[model samples]
Target chain A: MALASETPRPRTWWRRNQQRLTPWLFLAPGMAMFVFYVIYPIIASFRLSLYDYDGLSAPEWLGLANYAELWTDPAFTTSLYNNVLWLVLYLLAVPAGLFIAIFLNQAVMGIRIYKSLFFFPFVISQVVVGLMFAWFYAPNFGLLYNVIEYFTGKGVAILADPDLATYGIIAAGLWPQIAYVMILYLTGLNNVAPDQVEAARLDGAKGWKMLWYVILPQLRPATFIAVVVTVIGALRSFDLVSIMTNGGPFGSTRVLSYYMYEQALSEYGYRMGYGAAIAVVLFAIMMVFISGFIWKMVRDERGVH
Target chain B: MLHLRTGAYAALAVLLGTTAMAQQRTLNYYADFDPAPLAAFEAAIADFEAANPDIDVVLQNFDHEGYKTAIRNFLTTDAPDLANWYAGNRMAPFVAAGQFMDVSDVWADNGLDQSLGSALASMTIDGKQWGVPYTYYQWGIYYNKDVYAQVGVEVPATWDAFVANCEKFSAAGIDCLTTGTSALWPGAGIFDYLNLRTNGYEHHMKLTGGEIPWTDDSVRATFAEWAKVQPHITENHAAIDWQDAATLLVQGKAANYVMGNFAVAVFKEGGMTDETLGFMPFPTINPDVARAEEAPTDTIHIPAGAKNVEDAKKFLAFIAQADTQTKLNMALGQLPINAGSTVGDDPFIKAGFELLSTTPGGIAQFFDRDAPAEMAKIGMEGFQQFMVQPDQLDAILERLEAARSRIYK
Candidate 1:
């Protein structure tokens, strides 16, 4: 009996240290995956940015040279400028989503079907959406081209026009993005405090005023998620641009993501080192927003406690 | 019952082990092809597997554009035994990087040096042939005979006569040359022909090889000649792709399309018959300069890191045979490199074969194939922009010259 008691019983060990060890055991796989996939690649990409590798050969060390070249590259400048335009304009979808959500928030007959219909675009793949928009904006036989020609006496080929191509693609991106945000807001609206809205209505608060002062305050979590996703989506805008324009009509629609792809893998030549530098820049931009969101969440948690 | 089940499992395991041992030599082939040529290659693969029963041929095919991206990754990691590639400067980088095997011994053992004929030189780099070229085709002006008759002109053999015919087409209010520059390569086709005619083949090759500057006087002279005929080209060309431009030719809305012979199939599919569709060589620009045609050849190579190197070489030799080439190219609707290989009775194939074989200055692999891909992209983009705004020539050339210096360095 003494020898048996001296041995380590796994059941007793689990009982004694369960709370401390269980959470960490649960987190181990996820943490290991995040470290391997996300953290390791970021560090490796940073290291690769300082070299000159053509992907098929041994890498040559060229510290800061690739970054230095990017400073004067006309294509890089155009891509960065277009990325800024994308970020600024992509935010318009959030407000547009809110507007659509409010308009359909009523309990009218067959409104459930209408809500599902409104969420339809978000379910379709971005590639299909891009193709649909491309056909819609096609030069001679497209719907938009014909409509424009009927009014202006000249058809506008949106994807083929360098000045307007990015805008056309962003409009395609917004179709699905707006649908996604509207679904989020609709769910948030379902959980809104009705008593507060009714009290505000008694105090002469109605329509835009009530939505602003009373309802929006309750919709803060939804709004925060909407903004976060929109920001990330804007920065990662690649599929629509790739499908519709391919950075064509003189490389005018290229974003940092597409430009990096063109440099790293496209027929332009496999300059992996240069491509890594572009990715680092895009990541740095994304980190700013990511950190801010985390900081706000931490402060909110502390206030709640 | 338990004893019988275990016995059955042991037998099955032994059978699998023997089958695996028998299929020891497996050769992997990575191919990039359009649907039409892919069928031909598939048939050839079947024949090769049947001929060499001991060797197993594993084939993976990717579409043309997707393969371009996938090659860079696969060639370095998990490389196939053999992979399809292009010749000339297209293969130069891989050769320089030591990614492809030096298959000169296969060339010698099979007498490919004689069989390959004109393509042998292009396949060779640094005194060693890197790959075997299977098929190639010619690029020329495909014109509408009905439009030619409507404009009251014949096929012009010289540059001056071509310009006069364009003038007649202009008088008749039909665009003489319908090209799609939205994709940017059709415009480069025009630039290639003009340079080949004016400055000759050597200079054109040198320019694409990045030995000559974009702002050189010869290049400027080619552009000057091109500008003279710019008004005859289709307007608002940036809006449509090559197929749409070909549609204009099929509809008789445009007179001519300077493209590869592959476009003949498109024209035929668009209801154009032999009487309406005709092929002509790009008109002569310099009386003294010999004609050099754009005939891009498609080649296949064995990767240096391939596991089944000996079997790969055997496959290469088998495909290098004239009979194999004839069967393959005949199915592909392209001209085979071997003189003994017979192409289809298709008149365009005959004309392409005759033109490429008879040309004094030989062939080029088109702009995109000849030049480094980075420089080619910028060069084609500049060509497209120039088509839109010809007055921006100096600025465009300056930009291209800068890109050339950076890329070639």
Candidate 2:
């Protein structure tokens, strides 16, 4: 007791100013980057949405006008409807990818090569994929056209029909998106505990039941990733739409992003303020998933300790 | 310490200002055409510098197809000193926004009215001239002589004859028309021709500028006529790029191609020279309206934000000079914009002049260029959808009218 009192214990640097300096120092670079690239742009876009600025000219404020017009615009409705269709159709990729991943998980000769081959579409540029699918669906001479003609006694020019054009583009989009989902599932399958599978098998679990009870339970982490990826992919489905259709065949394939681009910065004209309003709506839609994700992540963090 | 800091900043400022001032002011020439034009521009620049002795010019060419997208992004940032753009309705949005310099004083001061053709009226919107048209060429039918000969049809010079020739070609198992709708602009030209013939230039002006109904009777009639001719067209027009359609002419597979003067190079490159290719004016169905101007012309403008605006203007003015205009187009085989400018000995260029001079009505900017881009897109897509399935015409029109109302509001 005398020794403990005789010499005061030296405090750590953190022990003195840790609360004040630590959060800031840890946050400095990341916070700066977030401010510069993400936060500022969001704020700027929000501010820009209140204007009628064509990018080349000075901005003019017509507050709430862009939003007012957006409400009454038929094109916006068409785009929003198509976006919903993309979201619904895009969810198919996750399950399709899981089945593919499970099928390819069997041990066999050249299985690695087969897996990579399956993964090829996702690795290829979306632009190239769009072009290939376009060729595949090309009216008369396309491979799919020939196959359909062989059976139906007629050639189906999928892209030219406004009724079918959006679906055609979405099918092309799935070619790559499924491949991305498959790769994620393949990774998850590698980490799935074999002990659980063996126990479930001993308990007389059979094919679909085995998967539903044992395999899927172990693959939650991968499912989470796959669902999040699919959601974001569905939301940001612009590149393929641009390359394949450009929202053509009577604007049948126009999504919110492409429509926003068309509104604010297309060869047609610049309506920057109107474009920003469209962007805000899209952001609000995306925020739904983002908030859920954040809530889940926070729950997971709390559960971590 | 304060004095030293002030002196240091003053010296730095002087250094920067002086460096910026004497930096040998290199002029940037951003264009969408081939290297041939840039190469020619350099030769012109050589002579210009030989006279001025104080400026430098740098020529950059983007892939013709990609340049439009590139220029769109570039214009929002620090753009080049001088860039090439289309005149008429194409330049209006840019000019209206004041992104481009007002070259009106330059035009008046240089007596451009006396030098350039009165056809420059298309480039002038709202009484302010924003750019000097470097050159322009008219649009017309470029038919394959071999295919036409095989089908035993002569070049049609009148509206009735044009349809008759199309029927002849269709009967002979040849696709009379081929175009691309992949990007929408190529197919947009089809609407231009239809609208030009059906409604004439004035109605086109009112309709494209959001002044008339997209479902107007005249517009519907244009699509109705297009539907009749649609079946004679290629099976997959979207499969072919505009150049690829021209290649069909070269291959003797197709009967005719309706295109602007820009397509001559493609035909020539494919070995369909003057002897193999024949040209005619866009036949006038309504011979009553005779405005006698030209179609979409190309312009080169110095941006208001250009660092070297004066020098950029000097370069553009030099390009507009009679001697340079003659030489440049002579090499590129384009029609010159200057009134006294000659096409030299190129057959294609000479044919272009004949087409423009003989066509009873004035030329018009292509539908996509002349109309507001939004309305133009809807109208053109409506036409394309109609062509594929004529049953959709009424629904397409009603939808377009809805879009039209929104734009006007």
Candidate 3:
């Protein structure tokens, strides 16, 4: 008792609390980074949305004027509409990926080679993919243009037409996105229980029935991941739009992400507050999905515990 | 003890070096120049250093496109002593934000009023000179002479004749006018020429300066003029780049291209000799309107936060000198802004010099330079849209009018 009393008080406190504090100490660096890089910027973007800033001049408090302008801005509407189109069209990757994964699942001659070939698009850079698709859709001497010209009397330039340009870019984005989804589903398929498949077969479940009842349930984790990634990917679709059309043929191809960049940072753009407002709207939209995801994840984690 | 001795020596060296640097003032200059022009500027810098032995000029080169975005950041955060930018309304935002230094004293002390008289109006804002222009290039119709000869068309001297030639060229299975509007600025060249030809320089300036409404009939007249040639502009032009359009002109698929003088290099590279490539002033639209020309001037300015203001002014004065501009522009293959500067012997250069120097109405900067950036962007898109769908002219004009009201205010 005399020895315990003689020991330093802070040292005893540290020894007593070390177990509870250890994990937090380990987490401190990463948490600090997240707060600084991610949380801080998001809060700052929210604050900036209420101001009018040209980046060169001091930011003036405008009190939601930028947001009000977004409602009236035609470009903002077009961008929002295109973003919806991208989200709906981009979701097509999941089923298409599942189909490809199933088709390529069988063991055949050089199956690995075929699988690798199928996975190749996702492995290449988005910029290169965008460039390739751009060339393919280019008018006059492009291969697709020539083919179309041969079929019809007049050639159609996909990117030149405002009505078709967004769809064309989305199609380009899907080429690699489908491949990415396929790889995820392939891994998920590998983990399916053979005993369950056998049991289902015994119960007269086959083909469509087998997949719907047994295979899909087992693939839920992969499907969840694929959907999450695709949602994020669709929202942040900037590079392909930048490389392919630069949101052009009269701003018809602008998605929300690209429009935000155009308003704040592009050669003609220095409207910081306006860009931040757009960013805020985008963040609010993203939060809906993210919160839904987090809610589900938390409930599932609780169930597991 | 040995480590302490080494640390002491290092500190001594740094102290001596800093004192030495302090004796010779350093002027940091940021410029965006292509390879050839960079070499020319380097040579000019060498001469400047030789002339002013006490000053050191350190030039940091940036990529052309990246420099536009970078300048905004650096000007506010870490400004250089000197930086390169465009003249007219292109510099207005920077000038208004107090990012650029007012260099009226530099112009006054150097007598630039007489020497660089051609660029005086463009360099001035709020009745004060903000920068010194070094080089400018003319915008006009660059054509394929071989295609014109094959199609049995004469070089048009008037807008009516030009439209007439367009029909003949289109009948001959060649595009009359070819411009790639994918980047959008190329279409602005066409608009600038059309507006200048239709309403003269004063009206064009007023239109770009936000004094005139886009819904005005005068602006509509320019679009009506544009509509005359719209059908004959190359199909799928919105998908192709300027270089690709140049290729079309080279291959005789397009007869004419409304472009700046810099496209000559692309034409030459595509195997078109000087004999086959031709330059003509944009044809007359209205006989009553005085002939104006588009010559976009590129200038350099000292940043407001510059440390070496005196030396920076000296550098600007040196750049404005006739001999310096002549040599610089010779290497740039562009026309010098200084009135006393001599142009090179290139045929295109000579043609541009003659065309600009003899203009009766005035010299106007290109559309993107003349108008505020947001207006320029929206206007160019509207122009591109008009080229695609002439029926949307009313809607496009309304949109532009809306933008102008918001932006200018």
Deviation of model 1 at B139, angstroms? 0.7
lDDT of 2 by residue, B1-409 (tens): 0011123565674466456657556676677766687666667667877777667565566777667667766776868798888877777767777778888877887778778854566768888788888767777778888898899987876667777888988888788877666666767677777677777777777777778787778888778767767887876665335775676678876777778878887888899878888877667666664533336777888876788888987887787788888887777667777877888676667877776656555567777777766677677777667666778788888978887886665
Off by over 4 Å in 3: A1-11, B1-22
What order do candidates take by TM-score, descending?
Answer: 3, 1, 2
Global lDDT of each model?
Answer: 0.89, 0.79, 0.93
Tens digits of per-residue lDDT, candidate 1, A131-235, equal: 999889987678999999999998888887778889999999999999999998999999999898889999999888998999899999999999999999999
Q: Considering summed lDDT, which 10 consecutive residues are worst modelled in model 2 chain B?
A: B1-10
- For model 1, state the Cα shift of residue B47 in Å: 4.2
DockQ of each: 0.56, 0.45, 0.88
Output the lDDT of residue A207, model 3. Answer: 88
The top-ranked prediction according to TM-score is 3
Backbone clashes in model 1, listed as residue pairs: none
| Higher-TM-score candidate of 1 and 2 | 1
True contacts kept of each: 0.58, 0.46, 0.90
| Predicted structure 3: clash tally | 0
Relative to the true interface, what fraction of contacts does candidate 2 keep? 0.46
By lDDT rank, best first, the candidates go: 3, 1, 2
lDDT of 1 by residue, B61-169 (tens): 7778888778877888879899999998899888999999999999998888988878987898899999999999999999999999887898999988988888899
